[model samples]
Target: MRAFLKKEWLEWSRTGRFLVLLLVFTVFGIMNPALAKLTPWLVEIMSESLTDMGLVASEVTVDAMDSWVQFYKNIPMALIIFVLVCSGSFTGEYEKGTFIPVVTKGLSRRKILAAKALLLYGMWTVMYGLCFGITYGYNEYFWDNSIAGHLFAAAACTWLFGVWVIGLLICFSAFAKSSSQVLLGTGGVAMGVYLLGMFPKLASFLPAKLMEGLALLQQVCEVEDYIASAVTSGLLVFLCMCMAVVCFDRKQL
Candidate 1:
């Protein structure tokens, strides 16, 4: 297990996947607060230009919540990038026929699947921590972070969502014959789950609620509203991993 993880870590670094994830999230982290602080100025500038057209501009409101808003907005894109980057996680192995000998050499298929999923989850954890830390520092430096309550709790929800995403990618990658198939499978599942949020009763149980991190911190939503979603999402993550293992055990490759 250690050897497998170490190899994956090295591969990520070598393939520049590590740096790509780090850079994408870090940019968003820094950009979120920066955008919040500068939006007022930008709006003012735009308002001036509009003044010549006899257009009255509404007041450009900027606050710490604005920063949190940026944080939440950027998170989905970051997760999308994460899903894309990991979409090929197992597909590449199968395509290259690399895992065949490893499985024959005594490594359990389940272990390989576990390692792949675990590594992706761990990478996401570290990147998320860095992104949050950077954003938190900048937000605090630029504005009053106190306005956002349950900061880490809000973050934990998104982090959990990322875990579920990783599990989904792993499971989909197992059944998918190619990276495109992997993307389609994961994306279809995501969209299907997301649409479930339309129903009031279903929203509480769907993982899509985790995206409302800003609302969570703003107290617009009480924790109870989505606590069930958090727990259910986590359970789904485990189930996805177990399903991946089951599917892989029966997979020819």
Candidate 2:
């Protein structure tokens, strides 16, 4: 497992795409706070322009919660870009017959799957940490230090949602012969789950709550509101990982 992880790191480093992702996501982190700060000003400017046109504008407001909202909302888009870039991580090697040498050398397929999962999860965690560190730093510098009690819980929920996403990708990739197929399959599954979560009663049990409702934790939600979703997502992530292992083990490479 250690050697497989090292190999994965080596591969990731040589490509440098990971570095690019880090830079982009960190910018999103920085941008979230900046936008939160600037939104009111932008709205005022628009309002003024409207006034010049003999139109009226209502009051607009911006707050720390808005900053975090931008953070969580932007993350899904960032994750999509990350997935697109990484979808080829395994499939590309398979297509080029590059993994044959490594697999033929008696590397356990389970280890390979585990290594990839671990590496990607680590990357996601690092990127998330960088984002949150910057966001918190800026929030402290420009806003009140006391965040809404549930903000951290919200962030934690989103982080777990991202893990579930990665797990889904891994499982889908096992059945997909091409990178595009893997991405489409994973995206479809995620969207399907999200749609199902839209039923009013399912909010408490759905992972989509992690992405949507968690951001509002500072508002009216009790801690228990997010607890169920978090637990469900954790279970889904485990199931997805196990499925990936089983599918890849039976897959002819």
Candidate 3:
């Protein structure tokens, strides 16, 4: 397992995907604070044009909360990019016939699936942490971070949402013959959950509600309000992984 994990790391690094993900996430992190800081200036630049059109542009106040809001907003986009990049985790191996050699050499299919899942989860965690850390540091340096309510809890909710998506990606990858199939299956499930979340009665029980971290930051919703969604997401992630392992084990390499 360790050797296979090492091989996966080497491939990720050598393929430039790892560095590209890192760079993209870093830019997102910086953009959160940078955009918040530049908001007033941007509004000022547009104020004259608005005045010419008989529309008044009011003064805009910026703060740590603005940056935090941007953080939550950018995180979903970051996760989307992450899912698109890693959707091929299993299908790529299938196409290259790489798994056959390992399975023939006595590597258990469960271990292979486990290793890939671990790497994907680990990468998501690291990238998410890096982005959060950068945003938090800049927010603290520029303004009072204490102004944001339930900051850490809000961030955790967003991170859990990403984990659920990763689980979906892995589960789909186990049975998909191509990357497009994996993306379609994963995205379809996510979209279904999102649609279900639109129903008031079902919203709390759906994993898609985990993306509402901004509500916590704004103090519009209590942390307790997310408990049901968090629990559902956790269960779905576990189920997805178990399904992935079972499917991969029985699949033809």
Candidate 4:
């Protein structure tokens, strides 16, 4: 298991996917604070045009909350990139028939699936943490971060949402013969959940509610409100992993 994990790490590193993810997350982290800081100046530049159009551009007030809002807004895009990059996790091996030799050599299919799951979850956690840390540090330096209510809880909800997506990816990868199919399955499930969440009565119980971290930060929704969604997300992740393992066990290389 350890050797396979090491090999996975080497594969990501050699292919530059790890570095690419790191750089993308870092850029997003910096952009959150940077955009907030530049907002006032940007408004000032537009002020004259607004005055000529019989409108007034009031003073733009920038704060830590603004940066944090940007953080939540940009994170979904980052996660989408992550999903696209990792969509090939199992399909590549499937195409090359690499798992046949490994399975014949005594590596259990369960261990192989477990290793991939571990790496995927680990990478998402690290990248998400790096992005959050960068934004938090810059926000603290420029403004009071305490103004954001339930900040950590909000971030955790968003992180959990990312983990849920990873679970979907892993499950789809186990059954897919190509990267496109994996992405289609993963995205289709997410979209179905999102549409289900549109119904007011069903919204709170769905995993899609985990993405509503901004409501937590704004204090429009209490931390307790997230309990249902968080629990559901966790259960879904477990279910996805179990299903992935079962499917992989029966899959032909």
Clashing pairs in 2: none
Question: Which digits, one per residue and each the tens of the lDDT, describe model 2 over residues 180-220?
Answer: 89998989988998998879898789888888643355667
| Candidate 4: tens digits of C-alpha lDDT, residues 72-136 | 89999999999999999899999988889889999999999999999999999999999999999
Regions of candidate 2 where Cα sits further than 4 Å from its true position: 56-61, 213-215
Candidate 1 displacement at residue 90 in angstroms: 0.6
Every model's TM-score: 0.96, 0.92, 0.98, 0.98
The clash numbers for all candidates, in the given order, read: 0, 0, 0, 0
The lDDT of model 4 is 0.95
lDDT of 3 at 248: 88
Output the better candidate (2/4) by lDDT: 4
lDDT of 1 by residue, 161-252 (tens): 88887888888877879999888888888899999999988998999988888888888887777799999998998899888888899998
RMSD in angstroms, all models? 1.3, 1.9, 0.8, 0.8
Residue 197 alpha-carbon offset, candidate 1, angstroms: 1.0
> Any runs in candidate 3 off by more than 4 Å, and if so which?
none
Q: Give the lowest summed-lDDT range of ten residues in model 1.
A: 109-118
Q: Candidate 4's error at 233, in angstroms?
A: 0.7
TM-score of 4: 0.98
Scored against the true structure, residue 205 in model 1 reaches a CA lDDT of 91
